[model samples]
Target: METIHLTYPETPDVVPSVMVLGFFDGVHTGHQAVIRHAQEQAERLNVPVTVVTFDPHPKQVLSNKPDAVRYITPLSRKLKRIESLGVERCLVLTFTKELAGLSPQQFVDDYLIGAGAVHVTAGFDYSYGKFGEGTMETMPFHARGRFTTSVVNEQTEGGEKVSSTRIRKLLGAGEVDAAATLLGSPYVICGEVIHGDARGRTIGYPTANVVMDASYVMPRLGVYATRVRLRDGRTFHAMTNVGRRPTFYDTGDVSIESHLFDFSEDLYGQLIEIEWVRFIRNERAFDGLDSLIAQLKQDETTARSILS
Candidate 1:
């Protein structure tokens, strides 16, 4: 898949294609449905499918407060997921104050019709233009007969809507198994292995400290059953802890430490992806090292059972 980055007032020469539009943060199940629908349209029209998404999130740029909006999948991971869906092109529009100020007609004219969009596909609730005044209901009118539009209605799982917000809430609440059900896959976070105090080694369970980008949404502060994949494609079953290590200190920075089962090779400075599978238990402070070691043993047993 080809990735094209664009800023407002700038355009790219392109071919007539079916445009799939959204700020697909997680590329979760509902987003998948929209992209798949666009894929079907592209197949019928014999045109390439161009996925149009925004970066840094519109909320981060538009919100008045200095709120950091966490993401389920960062830009790079999002593109990978979109490519896995067979998209031919990905157009990343850099969101800015100028682009956010465009009116409904101007946005369509500049971004859609003017860019060779023969057809557009988006979720039912998709919105555009200044203050989001343009929605799927108004997309056809904004098209001005230059292009057709298709709206994929709300996709649901277990009688509830499958959405990124809901998935984030699940991860926040440490319900990864439930989140995975809605996401159609495990929730994953990418990070680099960093040096730690080597405290786990003293306890016979050495761990790799995975430092991640602050933009990535973190699962609840607890241990979980996870699968770690290295950049070289090697994977292993692991038990990961997301906590502040209260057992060792009264207060400390929150950390992601994973003890890969049967792993012996060094991983420092290497990048890895951790796929959260199941929530084990809440993080807590143990009174003594012996107690913590016993619990670690128990956690390993439970995590192994779940991962297996």
Candidate 2:
């Protein structure tokens, strides 16, 4: 899919499309429904579906605590997910306070009607303009007879609305299995294999120390049944731990280390993706090295049962 970046006051000519609008952070199931509905409309109208999204998250610029704005899928991952759903093009608007201050009519005219949107599709709760004063209901009023709108209703899973907030809450609580049901896939973290203290090797269970971007919404600090995909597309069942090594240090920075089962090869400086499968146990300090090793052996057994 083609991606174009834009800022306010710069309107570029483009072909008419069935425009899908949202800041699709995770591209969760609900977001998928909206985009799929747009695809249907595009099929009927014989036009391509163009997704218009914002960058730096509006909350990053508008909220009092910008650093707290973590994401389920960061910009790069979100784009890949959107493209996997068959979106033809993407327009990423560089969000700023100036862009956020645009009046409802101005936003629609410049981003929608003026950008060659023949029809627009968004979730029911979608809104625009300064302080989000424009709702999908008000989209028609702003369309000015140049375009149409479709609002996909709330999508529910387990009797609750599927939302990014709910997913983040699940991840925060280490309910990755439950979150996967709502997300339609496993929660993933892409990171590099970095050097650690090389302590796991001493315990006969060498691990790859992964360091991901700070913007990712990390699963709760604990041991989890996980799958790790190497850069060469090799996947391995892993017993992953996300925590500070409490047994080694009284307190330290959080770390992600995964021991790939039956794998013994050098992986320093390589990139890998960790897919959370299920929660195993909370992180706890063991009495000694022998006790920690025993618990790790048990964790591996349980992870094998789950991933097998």
Estimated TM-score for each candidate = 0.98, 0.98
Per-residue lDDT over 1-308 for candidate 2, one digit per residue giving the tens place of the 0 to 100 score: 99888887777466799999999988999999999999999999999999999998998999898998888999889999999999999999999999999999999988898889999989999999998999999999999989988899999998999999999999999999999988899999999998999999999999999989548998999999999999999999999999999999998999999999999999999989999999999999999999999999999999999999
lDDT of 1 by residue, 40-107 (tens): 99999999999989987988898885367889998999999999988999989999999999998898
TM-score of 2: 0.98
Clashes of each: 0, 0
Question: The CA-based lDDT of model 2 is what?
Answer: 0.93
Q: Choose the strongest candidate by lDDT.
A: 2
Q: Candidate 2 regions off by >4 Å?
A: none
| CA lDDT, candidate 2, residue 241 | 97
Full-model lDDT, candidate 1: 0.92
Candidate 2: clashing residue pairs, number:
0
